[model samples]
Target: MASCIQIEGLLQSYIDEEASVSERLLIEEHLKSCGACSERLALNRATAATLFEVWREDQLREDLTRRVMAHLPEMPPPTSVSAALRRQVVVEGQRTRRWLGAAARLMPVFTPVILIILAGLLWVAWPSYYNMGGDEVIGMVTYCDANPDATHYSQGQARRLHVRNPIMPDDHFETGEEERLMLSLAGPSHITLLGQAAVQVRAPRAIVVTRGDVFFDVFRDNRRFQVHTPDGTITALGTSFQVSASKAGTVVTVVKGEVLVDNETSFVRLHENAQTAFTATERPTVRQGIDTSPYLRTARAVRPDPDAERRFLTQFIRNATHTPAPTEQVFVVNTERRHVNALLLKWMPDPYTSGHAGYTVYVSDSAMAPVFKTTISPEIFQDKQNNMVRLEMPNDMRRHDTHVLHITVMSDQSSGPVETTFTEVAAIGEAS
Candidate 1:
């Protein structure tokens, strides 16, 4: 025999007097020792009894309604209209009783199911109910390079934000002049910091940009992705846009999707390829279909490293060399790279040049064409016999970004083949 302790379903059958003799005896004996089971049985019995009483009362009411109709017919067969109306009333009452009987039978089965569904709904809506603006990590630094360049302030000290670093609410991301930071948000939203920018993630789904050019590509979401600026706020449901902030004001350019730009006075909805500008105290001036190509091109462009660019320029100049080239060459720039661009020294050794001939060193930033030309006489050589040349570049090196040096031998002696060798080995800087 199955144990009564494990037979919760059997209680219903036992209360209905439908259990076998042996099962009833087992339950009776089990209830004597188990207070919880006895209480549950009593509650079930009381509920059953209550439902039975309600059903009996309804049946009695239904029977009395039928008896009253039968007695009224015996008293008088009324007019045709009255008799037909009475018949309709009796039919409707019978239908109502049938419906109520079915409903009462099904209520017990669906009551628990309805409660479970309601509980699930509440659980799903819990966040919205409490307005959980907690510092939960919604996303991480998906692509962050230039270590110690892009940083976030934490506990009075600035910490570097590297790849895979989790981003929390109120987390501030500030980049140096040369650094750019990329972040991914919860809605699969992407933010690309192109230049020197300072941004802090506000609670939930918003970011405040204080400076620099920031590109945002937010995927579709129920919650809006907000970009808070000094001038106004740009909110989007699903869009790719650019926000360029400066001292003058902020300019919002819509690249693909639509966005709403709100300021102190009013709000304007901007569509694709539309642009708008706003000042700190004023509302945004809307422009429609006004080509956003400039911002679009910039958003798609990658920032080249200054050091790598300098090296490429050096190699281009060094490629135009004949046999027995100058074995020694040096190029050096100041260490203060981000804030300043200065070429401190550039020394190239030419061993075969004539001592009496004047030399010309052509310089350019792109190495495509010479923008500057410096003529050096043989008497100016630091080492005369060795044909060593230390020609001072055009004084505009500090003003411009001088990368490549093209030294063409301006031999006043005998211009045999126009000797040219811009030998660039390694440029070492002085104490910076």
Candidate 2:
């Protein structure tokens, strides 16, 4: 016999129709057998029913009255002023409006001064603050324990992007909706998927798929190696690869690397020389006889459009390869001279072949490596003529080097992953 306190815990489950059959039966049996419990349940149900009935009636009456009132003419607020005073008030209001308009125009001139003063005040009030010294900021100034000592690119010129995990159990996820999943990885690494996808931290760094397909582009210094799906699992030994998983099972074709497919019936190892397919109830099968060239051809045909793919691909390549163009620049010069207020990296045609196109942006230091990254939701793509991103320095963030940016642009349906990179340059005063 559960105590009343314990029974109360099940109340919400009961109301939500989520209680197990055994729990429901136990509750019903207890209500029938125990007089006090029965009375309490009856009273609670009756009260709920009564409240619902009353609320329904009240809402209905209010809606009817609102409809009736909507048909009636609206009356203006009553005023007691004499005709002369009313006319005077109107003239004074017009004069006030004109003054307000003049002040609004002058506000822009004063805004810069106010901002400078505030910055001065912050410096004066907190003079001891300086750039935080850590391996992240010092870059080659410190020892490279896990990374290479050789120069991958110029640290000062490249934009560093940090991409964080986008799918946590605490994160809001809707089923059947295409979501752009961004993750942080050392070096130039990215993952993008269509439909429902969730990432888990343990055991080969897994991402469980609720529905749809996913694509991963992994680079150097990354340890993550496995992707789990409903039909089968794809485990990477090393190198670059692309895999598509659905209800029909998983089709794994290596671009430049090797992977192991573990189906329930058999285990098959796929190397750079071969492609493999696996299903839930069947054994892993290798296709050694098929020509790899045709597969690549069909893949290109099924792949998202070249223009849509270039958006994300360009961002990553931009970060990975930063030989200053002889006569061209990617970012436009800032007119306001404010701290790089916003960085927008966009791609088009919904980033996919079957559905609408889209683009996403990330902020980091190493365009090739990102510590934290995510997609820009409610993003405006393709129509941005001017830089519209606004970033607040020190308040919104403190300027630090060794930070990296990785952007991944994805399509709506039947598309693949396109990744990009941008590096944040220290503002004029912060460049030491």
Candidate 3:
């Protein structure tokens, strides 16, 4: 009979089906005789099953990323374009000089007149050179989900786009289910599309996304990249992010660097590993962490960089413990006594804290003396990314006067109390 310690050492190998025939027989015989060992084996089996499922899921995700990135159009080195242009210019200049030399030999008197004409021609073609510079290829379709099914609409005609097709300004690409497209853009940016995504390429440096989820791996330079959505616009200096658009709302997740989400009602900035969801009606609600498994998987497909996973894990672990509670500068709307139904307070707490012991809202008629007090439950803060607490104002307390509201966080740790205060002026039809 195998001892527990011996069985423990072989458990993983046995679960993985990596044990030899003799080892398997021994483990099986031992498991049959000992109930505790059997139970332990059963638990190991369950854990193995769970791990296998997770591994399978990861494999599938990795496969999808691989296929998508493999299809991205190949981009040549950055110096290629300028080098080709310079070669062309040199060739043209040589031809012109040769022609001018022959004419000068034939008619020395008219040579000066020909020189003036040639100079004028060069000046006339200068704008064409300027326009050619603007014609820098921004993005190319490296892979299309289904070459026949995917359609590109440009210049009032819809046609199928194949691999190596350049995506130009005003070009609209739409994909169906089971169809994905990958784009290699300037700045060495990469974008992958999934699930009925429709993206329109805009001039200069912008993309308009009408639907679906798109992942971006953008390299930051001096230029700004922008994504226009139905609910709002996302602007990034240089970052890797994912934007998902649906009927419900738009969600932006920043994997690396930061981005600014702006709509008519609100403007919010999201940092690395942060996420935010925006709706047409509501304000942007910020969240702590973003699930970057899909993006990271796709990035690995684009370029198998071992450091990418290490960096992600490192940042994730650091965020869990090191991120401080966020302080917010908020503007209070509808502060009029008659219109103020509730005092809305929004904040973000440190996720590493054990638990919150509820909060107290102190409303004072004067800065020194408190007039009203409201205590809120910790339930108001639980599992909330953007913590919002709304306390109803008493009819008597809603006077046409300026009041100071103080909020303090109650926690188990002795790191000292976290508190913030804002002054609210209650005047009819006025907000301050």
On lDDT, the candidate that comes out on top is 3
TM-score per candidate: 0.38, 0.30, 0.39
Which scores higher on lDDT, 2 or 3?
Answer: 3
- What local lDDT does model 3 show for residue 73? 88
What is the C-alpha lDDT profile of model 2 across 255-308, one tens digit per residue? 545677786777887876477777787887787644544333322223333343
Candidate 1 C-alpha lDDT tens digits along 252-284: 998777899988887889998898999766867
- Winner by lDDT between candidate 3 and candidate 1: 3
**Poorest 10 consecutive residues of model 3 by lDDT?**
412-421
Which one wins by lDDT: 1 or 2? 1
Give the candidate number with the greatest TM-score.
Answer: 3
Give RMSD (Å) of candidate 1 vs. truth.
Answer: 33.7
